[model samples]
Target: MAINRILIANRGEIALRIHRAAHEMGIETVAVHSTADADAMHVRLADHAVCIGPPAAAESYLNHAAIISAAEVAGCDAIHPGYGFLSENARFAEKVEAHDIAWIGPKPEHIVTMGDKVQAKKTAGELGLPLVPGSDGAVSDPEEGRKIASEIGYPVIIKAASGGGGRGMKVCESEDKIESLMSQAGSEAKAAFGDATVYIEKYLGNPRHIEFQVFGDGNGNAIHLGERDCSLQRRHQKVLEEAPSPVISDEERERMGEVCAQAMRDMGYRGAGTIEFLWEDGEFYFIEMNTRLQVEHPVTEAITGVDLVREQIRIADGKPLSVAQKDLEFRGHAIECRINAEDPFTFAPSPGKVTYYHPAGGMHVRVDSGLYAGYSIPPYYDSMIAKLIVYGRDREGCIMRLRRALEEMVVEGVKTNIPLHRELLHQKDVLHGDYSIKWLEEWLESRED
Candidate 1:
């Protein structure tokens, strides 16, 4: 069934992104937003709009019934839940499918299998992907946890099976701290996800966070676009991302890309997904797989010259992939800076009316934002206000262009992390692309001192 109109069950830049893609494909869009987002850019641009609920995400975005009702009322035949919110909710996908609406994402069962950290690791192992040595499943006994930590050596990490964003995680350097850390992780997990099941993994001391973007047609065909380096992070949240990691060679990319694509093909997966890995000393260890369009997907698109959102809609409509593995080519280096509405130094949220707004513009520079002069940023949602993506023929050229673009960007009335990004570009390690997952935090700490 062709999707005539899609309900963008999201807000902010991502919703606007989907609206643009759908419109480009000659399909109309319905923007379902909370009352606070009534004046949002996406809602203003969409063919139709609906106010679902109040400011709270639980009462609006996460309210599956309200979203479904909004879609039905708006005459939408498909629903696109952009990254975050209900994007990876397996039951929510099932509900949408049950309501006879096309879900522009991965299969419901695949989402369920990849959503659980323990189960995802097991599946990765079965798919012949290398995994970090750790417990086979959830560790309920302190004695067993100690045994696993000992065998895996010291510096093991306890993680929630159903958690992300560094919430239910603890890294213990010795066996003596295993029991306490496990209990703490379990308690944090329960408080965060309502699931206390925690798993253990060998802690990587200093590894680059690399992830491969993949797409499937839900039949047996799948292909990988390439890898993104997301090592520049703070408190487990990515601040910036780049495609075609500086460390990976063309041969390495082909080898790993084919491996990832084959894994998705074997599973008969559908839509877009990212397989995240930790790279250290030339070895790749699987961490987890996000079963939805990632926030940093624009970097991949810029490098590959593929419209991921368009491909997602086509795939959901039972169409085959537009490009095969051989036809796809990596042309240039692309970097994306996640601009947040927060204090650059202290990282405190600064949500308010924008007195003035200007985004950078030039060759190969793209800014995905919803901010305008008089629009007020609601404090109830994510702090990210824009994504500045720039591309170049090479990494060095990319950095040079990105530096210039940063200088051109201006957001007034509210504090923004633009200053932080400017400072980051001047760092020696960042310039040489010689950093790990711990680099940004260490750099931030040094700045404070």
Candidate 2:
């Protein structure tokens, strides 16, 4: 099915990203938006724009019927849910397919399988991926959990089976604390994800968050782009990302890249996906997989020179991957700082008018944003307003370029985390790329004391 026109079923920089790719591929785009986003950059730039509903996300962005209706009315041949809202919704993917419209994402079954943490871990292990040692599946029995904790050694983490974002996670260092922590984790999981099921895994004291970018044609063929180090996070939310991790060697990358690609091929996966791992002591442990394009994809793009969005559209059109494993090459180092509309230090959301906006500009600096001087950022969505990405020949050069870029960036009216990113670049640990997943939170804590 050739995708002549695509309905972009998302908002913000990602939607604009999709629109640019579709246009580059000679495919027209229809931008769907809430009333609040009618004046958005993507909406204004798209070939066609449709107002789905009101400002509230539930009444608009998450409204499946309204989106499908808009797609049909716009005569769109495909729907591209760009990394949020309904992007990973298996039911929504099925609904689009039922309507005879191409779904520019992973297959619905793959989404379903990977959406659940326990099932994803099971499948990853079956596909020959190394997993953190612990319980096989959801463990409800307190005594069973105790036994597993004792066997796996102490300091095991309890996590929700149905969701992530650190909501339903607890760490127990001793055997006596397993039952209480399990109950607490289960309660939190039930409240956050509507599922009380929780699983157990051996706790890694300090690990770097490493994820590989992979693409599949849904025909038992796949390729991995490389790995991104996302260890700089706050509350499990990524703050900055970089490609060709400062630590991973070329030999390790090749070894792990093949392992990841083979897993995708074994599953008959499709579209863009990320396989996340916790790296410690020179070994990688599988965590979970995101069956959709990630927020930190730009860094990978900068290093690999691959237009992921364009590849997604091509794969949806039943085309084979443009670049093969042998042809793929990692060129340089790239870093992306997620600039959010918030208090840089306190991390509080700040949504309002953009009094002034001057994004960083240079040869290797790319700013993905939808803000303008007079634009009003509505308070109804995610706080992230921009992504500042920079590339150079090496890690040191990348950081130097990124520092210069950050110095030039100016976003007024609404507060942003620009200062946080600037501070991070100055840290010795960050400069040496010797930080763990707990680095940011601890750094922030030290700032207060």
Candidate 3:
């Protein structure tokens, strides 16, 4: 069956992203928006729009019933969750498929399996990937966590099974701190994710975040595009991303890419996914697999020239992958800096009307945004307002182009982190690519401004 119309169960940039991809392929789109987002760009651009609910996400974007109903009423044959809200929610995926609407992402089973930390680790290990030594299952008590820590060596990391963005994670340097940290982690996990289950892993003090973009047709055929270095982050959230990791060698990329492709095929995975790893001391340790499109996917798209959203729609329409591994080629270096509506130094939200907006534009520069002059950034959503992406013949050239783009960009009324990004780009360590996941936080602390 082919999907002629898809309902976008999302808002802002990602919803617009999906709309663009679907329409480019001559497909129609239905956009669902909350009261706060009634005038959102996605709704304004889509062929059909529906008001789901109020500003509160629980009653709107996260409300499965409302989204599904909107899809049905709008005559959509498929629904695209667009990376957040219910994007990785297994039950949501199942419900969409059960209603006879194609889920334009990985299968529901894949979502459920990979959403659990312990299960995801086991699955990745079974796929022949190197895993960081840790607990084989969920550890609810301190004794069990301590035992796992002892077996894996000290300085272990306690994590929530449903953790994300660095929440419900604690570093225990010794057994003395295990019990307290375990209880804290569990409590946080329960409150944050509605599940108290926690797990443990060997903690690497300094590691680079690398992920490979993979796709599958659910018929044992899959391929990997390449790797993206997402080491520059704050509090486990990526602020900047680049493709063709500066640290990985050509041989390493080939080996890791093959492992990712084969693993997807073995798992019978379908649609776009990212296999993340922690690279430390020349070794890649499997972290977890993101079963949905990542927020940083634009950098990968810029380098590979693959429209991943379009690929997801095609795969959902029961089409096989149009390109093979050999057919894919990395063209140039690409970088994306997440432009956020916040106080750059304090990192506090700066939500209000955007009095003025001027996005950067030039050869090899692209800005993916859902904002314009007079647009009000709702406090109800993520702080990110746009993604500034740039491509060049090489990494150095990409940096130069990105610098120019950042300077040309301007957003007024609400403060933005553009200044922070500009300053970071000028730093010697960042320019030299001599940093890890921890580097961004430490750099922020060191800033006297």
Candidate 3 residue pairs that clash: none
Off by over 4 Å in 3: none
* TM-score per model over all chains: 0.99, 0.99, 0.98
TM-score head-to-head 1 vs 3, winner = 1
Model 1, CA-based lDDT: 0.96
Better of 2 and 3 by lDDT: 2
Residues 339-391, candidate 3, lDDT per residue (tens digit)? 99999989999999999999999999989999989999999999999999999
* Clashes found in each candidate (C-alpha, N, C closer than 3 A): 0, 0, 0
Model 2 CA deviation exceeding 4 Å by range = none
Q: Over the stretch 149-174, how does candidate 2's per-residue lDDT look in tens digits?
A: 99999899999999888999999999
Checking candidate 2 for backbone clashes, the offending pairs are none
lDDT of each: 0.96, 0.95, 0.93
The 10-residue segment of model 2 with minimum total lDDT is: 79-88
Deviation from truth (RMSD, Å), model 1? 0.7
Candidate 3 achieves a global lDDT of 0.93
